[model samples]
Target: MKKEQQEKSFTMSGEKRSKVYEEEAAYLRNRRSVAGTHTTDRSGIAFSGGGIRSACFSLGILNWLERSGMWKEFDYVSSVSGGGYAVASVLEREFDGEGSGKTRAEMVVDKLRHDDGYLRSKSATLFLLVISASISGLLTFSPIMLLCGQSASLMINIYPRTVDNWASGIFCAASAVISLSTWRMPGMVGKLTLFIAVFFGSIQVAWVTGYLPPNLRVGMGILLILSWLIVLGLLGLGLSHPLIKRIQRASFLGLMANIVLTFAIVLHLVIDGTGKTHTNDVLACLYIVSLGLIFLALLASPNRLNPFLVTYYKSLQTAFGNGRDDAIWRNRAQQGDPIHLINCFVQSPRTREEPVRSRGGENFCISRFFCGSQSLDYFRTATWSSGREKKPVWRHQTIWRLITTSGAAVDVHPTRQSPIVNGLPTMFNIGLCSWVINPSFKRKHRKGGPVFVLNFAAAVGGNSIKQKWIRLSDGGHFENLGLYELVARQCMDIIVVDAGCDPEYRFSDLALAMEKCRDDFGAEIDIPGLFPQRSPGRCHQSKFEGYIRYRGVDKPAKLTYLKLVVTEHHSMRMRLQSSIDPKFPHEPTRNQFSTKAFVDAYYQLGCETAALAFPVTGTVKRAA
Candidate 1:
């Protein structure tokens, strides 16, 4: 019995040992997951949006960091729009801490120098133009033709077979617009008032215009009345009490309206088609397809088709502008070229204070070479676009390369010897770089790499205050650029490179965006609350220097904002123009970047700047 007891004790002790080992292993696994591989040393680098110039500058900074043997310090890099291209370039090169024979900076520069033709290829431009034209045709120009035909059918009864189709199309569009516009109107009275007014107005107009047959007019009126009753009943229920609050909270009101409109239009078309000709059927089909395209164009993101024009016109009444063209007017009304904007600012030579005379009496200045720079005030109050001065609207920044001078471009400080119009850094394109980081926080639906293509315009919901779908423009639209992304990832250290267009080179954008991020995302980040604005004679030492300390509840990240402003002599534009068209004396030199020297210079500069930030390690070679 004593021998048996000894054997049993041994078995029990062995089992206990195994169990303890399993528990310890599980604990380590959980700890590993809770704190990522680099939890203690988590760091991120963000590049702000400044088109191609900012991108090139980011490459330069990356090169310098890599040379300093600190590239490995960064776990992830993020950027907005044009900055996205830079992040992509760096990721694609995948430069290990040590250069892979040729440094990524060198590769990037070399690629740009040799790949200029690809960017400016007729095929690429044609492709963009074709897409633009298709979008225009499907949404705008084509609809005009359809509307004209429908109008004629209503007034002159030319297409008797198609009268009902035209009337139904009109009703569908009107209903959708009304539903979307008034969906958020508080109180049942306001919503009901608008709905009744719109419904009655539409039916009366159709009757007066001969859009409805006299015999079916009564039936149509009764149908519309019943439809309105169902809608009103639903709205009443939605706003009544806590019981129906769940359904209201779901906010499927938009969907409900859409369903009702679709049903009503289809029913009318089907009933009217009982004795209609085949010609009518085809016309009806065409009308339906065209209407669908219109809705799709309006509702879809601008990435697929440039919808700036549509929104611009829609908001013209509220937009601030003189509604007049001027000499200093750049292509503010045209679509911005993200690539060219980047190239022009980073590479172009600074213009002299005196204007160069060009053909047709056009005074060529530096401001004429860039667009979308005038509207980049990080701290400026937001306002709708009205054709007037002092309004911070997106379209104002749309100015194309205007060669003429304007008050907007000039710094009116009395201390200046002359009004400095072109002195401002054009690449300081609002320091606007939108970033979507924190894979965990990304909308569950937006899986995959769609994160890269996301711009400021895509992330926001409809403006609840305006009761209009926010026409999301570029990442610059919101002004809350890249810094927030780093914070969201719980990065312990963040290095930011703001190569945007800033005349004073103040970190206003960085400060404002950070504060805004805190407000919007509950991000715990902090910057100088009373940071001084850019002023002359202040030594401006703060230009390339500033830091924002994270002051959140959780352990904060150390933030560093580096202003990477490239001078004219070192600019890629000047280098490109000198090599490509050095002989132009009588005309303004157009910007281009298709050479090796320019690439070498930019690459070297980037390396040098990064090296300055983190000097190379000699005794120990730290992995990036």
Candidate 2:
């Protein structure tokens, strides 16, 4: 009976996966038909992420495509991070169905030119971020401090200062060190040491603080020692035993708890045992300030604030057009334009075990018809909600919100497990960006809202998929070039725009995408023209035609790669280099507050590079 039930469950899961694939295929077919490109051949253009620089560069490419009448040839536009900025703005304007008597690229460029400081200047938003951090610190740390204070007071009353207290403290510290060191080991030795450390240290603490009779303490200590020996004997068995694994995990957790409790008691005793009210008050204020600073450093650092400022600036009415932000997911794609795939990373919920793959998360795509990923399956975008009953839930998010979520370039990348290692630049503000929604069913009950504690816990815990809520951040955290999704869909002809920061032209983003594509989809991408001989005066080749041979597919698909680099032929490059900064196109991506000249220079560079790569007569060919 149990076997039959297990088989039934497996069959249901397989059916769900099939349904997701079919729905995605149907949506793509409809989009291709709308663009008049519903053929056996599939083509797509990918925009690489590099903040404002990439946005301007992609706009220029789009402008050239519009002028050359090649904009409608492709069926999909895949973008990540800043690359999504330009695409989202253009699509949102088109969805409004209001004619502006200008090309899509021109309208976006004009708006950006007028508001050149859109990415830099947001005093109000920055203030809000700081305030949010302060409040979060108070709410999160206050209870912890109060608990520590009560524990300290209880210890003072119950346990008088004795010589054994010092010994107990020493044992506690040693146990913490041993338990932390166990993270590096996976064998029985690590688990055995952890069990011994936790048990011995805990017994010492109880014996010293319990204030029992000497004979009773001696009896309890001997019993604990015997129990510890028995546990050590059991460790001789294989580590694969379920009971052993659980005990190992429990011992580690207990070790951490013991360390924290000891520190709190010591800190409270030192601060409040002064017996002078004035001194205690001063020390308490200092302690609170220290806590506030720690939270501020983690939550409201400049790196974290920059993404929020960029998102806020782009979401403004003046930036996109003077109209209400009424555009929804279903209307984001127009009839003649290609379907826009705004890629983001869905941070998985952490479990006890560490993740084997990308530590940051998986690739999540948001489009008009569907919103989800391959691992999580697909859901209808029209009726998607947060699913939590804590507050009023919206049926769908606006186009601007979706774009902001996609472009949220926080410091947490897919390679690292902790944000602290990256200087704690994780995005904790839930209002400005980062949307939480049900991954599978549209109406399933999901806990939602801006709970800072829960969000911070999720960020620290790393990414997994076994939780009630998923956090979405910058797609660049997984793949900056935005080509992975297109390759996953098996596009036959792909044009990639490489505008990321690459001063030496290393092509790291492209390399990352290549590695991931080969591993995930068994696709082999080869571009011989990427490496060219350098010339002093003339332009180095930035456009290369490659081919991708997908597994099980007979013929290789054509790939067009376009990169942004300085060339002596472009007049703007010479002019910008001479008058302004030497690094014209390769400026730091963090320079969101670029001057008007810088913005125009990048835009013109994009146009110049595209013109040189593919002349007016050039066209994107459909796959044979």
| Top candidate by lDDT | 2
TM-scores, each model vs. reference: 0.45, 0.73
- What are the per-residue Cα lDDT tens digits for candidate 2 across 257-283? 354345433543454456434544644
Supply the TM-score for candidate 1.
0.45
Give the range of the ten consecutive residues with the poorest summed lDDT in model 2.
8-17
Model 2 gets an lDDT of 0.63
Q: What is the model-wide C-alpha lDDT for candidate 1?
A: 0.38
